[model samples]
Target: MYAIVNIAGQQFKIEQGQEIFVHRLDGEEGAAVEFDQVLLVDQDGKVNVGTPVVEGAKVNGKILAHVRGDKVKVFKKKRRKGYQKETGHRQDLSKILIEKITF
Candidate 1:
């Protein structure tokens, strides 16, 4: 079975045993998390979609580790005025393993 769920303001299609990276979440590594914002689910070609979220539907996962995304560099330069600026950023993230989905 596969499901579409909301995590950290983003939507993702997930399945059992699948690992995915999402915006950082609270709790420590090996922590168990449950997401109830399941938008849709498909089991053997039969689909169930919720208006906003499926009541009583949930996705269970385990927090494997906390990670950071690659740094993004931002640079700005102005003409002969000789004005330049540069910045870099990395997004905090979490790696999770989907354990199960239930409705």
Candidate 2:
């Protein structure tokens, strides 16, 4: 079975035993977390979709690690204006292991 769930304001398509990196969450490594905002689920040939979100549906995952994503550089320049800017950023992320989806 697979499910589309909302985690940390982002939607992810997940399946059992799969690991995904999402926006940083408020929990320590190895902690258990549950996401209730399941938008859709498909089991074999059966499908269940929610109004906004599926009622009585949930996704459970375990926090495997906390990490940072790759750095992104931003550069801006204006010709003949002698203006230039450079910046970089990296996003904090958490690795989660999807354990199960239940309704």
* lDDT (0 to 1) per candidate: 0.97, 0.96
List the candidate 1 regions with Cα displacement exceeding 4 Å.
Answer: none
- Residue 57 CA error for candidate 1 (Å)? 0.7
Give the per-residue lDDT of model 1 (tens digit) for 1-103.
9999999999999999999999999999999999999999999999999999988999999999999999999999999999999999999999999999999
- Per-model TM values vs. the true structure: 0.95, 0.97
Model 2: lowest-lDDT 10 consecutive positions: 1-10
- Per model, state how many residue pairs clash: 0, 0
lDDT for each residue of candidate 2 in 20-100, tens digit (9 for 90 to 100): 999999999999999999999999979999999999999989999999999999999999999999999999999999999
RMSD of each: 0.9, 0.7
Residue 2 lDDT (model 2):
94
